[model samples]
Target: MAIDDAISFKKLEVFLAFMKLNNMARVSELLGVSTVSVHRSLHSLEEAMRCPLFKREGRSLIPLQAAYTFAEFAQRAVEECEHGILKVRETAGFNAKRLKIGSLYSLTLRCIPQLMIGLKLRKPVLDIDLTLGSNRDLLQQLADGKLDAIVIGVHTKSEFHDALDPELLSIPLFDDDIFLAAPLNSPYSGQTQINLTDLHQEKFVTLADGFVTSQDFWYCFEKAGFSPNISMRVQDIFSLINLVSGGIGYSLLPGRVAKFSSQIELIPLESNYGAQQRITLLLPKIRERDPNLLALTAECRMYGRHDGKKDGFL
Candidate 1:
């Protein structure tokens, strides 16, 4: 059979399943078919590709190098198909304009809401589905096609340049300064300057692991040459502020969050430990030309441009 005629969607699906599970029985179980059916599909796929995808050894079938490479393409193809199906269904049955977005929980306060509103004004019929999580989670969702774009904080240093996936396209939004949050009545609240070492004995509150703030909080301790005495770990920035307001423990946060509460005081660090966090909009390069995503990118850039000019960061 010619390559075009031999390859079927089900065959590719079975090929991907075999690559992942590496067991005919398991692939069959996952595909809701008999093992014999899965075996036939695998044979059909290998023949269509005209390449050795596996090496049989005893009762085990070890995948060849080409199999790994093919699996990557297969996964992408499957995801794109699913994406197309979803778009079609949303347009046909729902008759509702839809765009899926993910963001760091912190941006919900100012950045995300503004972007969504801007997009809505440009496309009044558009409906946005927003998912809020940590930087890592949002990025994962974007790469998985669960989100069209993500707003997150990237370190302005090495991490900004090196940590992201090469295939992801990013747009820098603004620069935010990191600050320490303390109770309004705390002694540190009245201080002209404070070092992390000065608060060595004082308990601290922190965002739980996986958040960008959590990493920055630890980075401060590393810079101050001491370990933080963390008293609590919360899921969101608001909760961290509430804890500080109630005299639970002091915490470090980006400047944007300081406006959320007047009960807490923000203290600027005296040393170079006050690193700037870069707020960024990230999307998959593959979806760069998507119409809905293009509109979103335009709004984000327009907002960034205007905000940057207003703030003198452009």
Candidate 2:
């Protein structure tokens, strides 16, 4: 016989709860509904199935043998539906136990670690897979669905802003000033601030073309109206930092990297050539409600709120 229109997955859930609890009040409590609602659900489920699944004794419902037999099929149906839903979500890269995060290598010094710790506290079971790359690379990966979320720096006047997808959501975390990275014993180290024009003739080691720092590097120099004497270009921020620390050359870097190495000092740039790297958390808008992304965004918001009170550029 065909099932009645009253039969639904929700009603089956209520029926299963009633079959297991056997007490309408307890079922109501378990399902967070009124006892009357639970009783009505069971009665409707019985009517829909055209079966006396329960024998009513006053206000209590005693499961008949048919109820027990049917429960096996109902439980299987529920379990299979749940599994199917999980599979669909997994395929869509939603509600997965693993969270794929992309970030700039520079953020690993403090920002990424702090965010990860807080995220772990919120979702202990979530496995975070981190991929570090330049801003351009990370953004591309995120757009291609290779990464679920990314933490990257975007300059105020940058073309990177235009590269952002309309479908992506951006959460601003904090702004980090671009600084002239100098070795500890460099001639400019003791200065309060350095003008970009003064660094026009200075040899510099910069990250390659795709990094946000590289863009900032070029932009500042363009403002200075002269090309820097680029001594070397590296693929990663750490390498650029090492090159600068080892006295290879000066580089324009984010102030956040100040704490990454003791041998390197970040000197403020002249205002005319200064730029602020806006550290932002970006995720697909479609998955904004995903639990892992929600946790990450919460941590990012907390970080942004408490950012100014912190001493260093974090």
Best by TM-score: 2
Candidate 2 residue-wise lDDT at 190 = 82
lDDT (tens digit, per residue) of candidate 1 on 119-140: 8888888889999899878878
- Per-model TM-score, in order, reads 0.68, 0.74
Compared to the true structure, candidate 1 yields what TM-score? 0.68
> lDDT score, residue 138, model 2?
92
Candidate 2 local distance difference test against the native: 0.86
Candidate 2 vs. truth: CA RMSD? 4.4
- Residue ranges of candidate 2 with Cα displaced over 4 Å: 1-82, 307-314
Q: Which ten residues in a row have the lowest lDDT in candidate 2?
A: 305-314
lDDT string, candidate 2, 11-121, tens digits: 889989888877888888888999889878888888888879988788778899999998899999999999999899897778788999999888887788889999999
**Runs off by more than 4 Å, candidate 1:** 1-96, 308-314
Candidate 1 has its poorest 10 consecutive residues by lDDT at 305-314
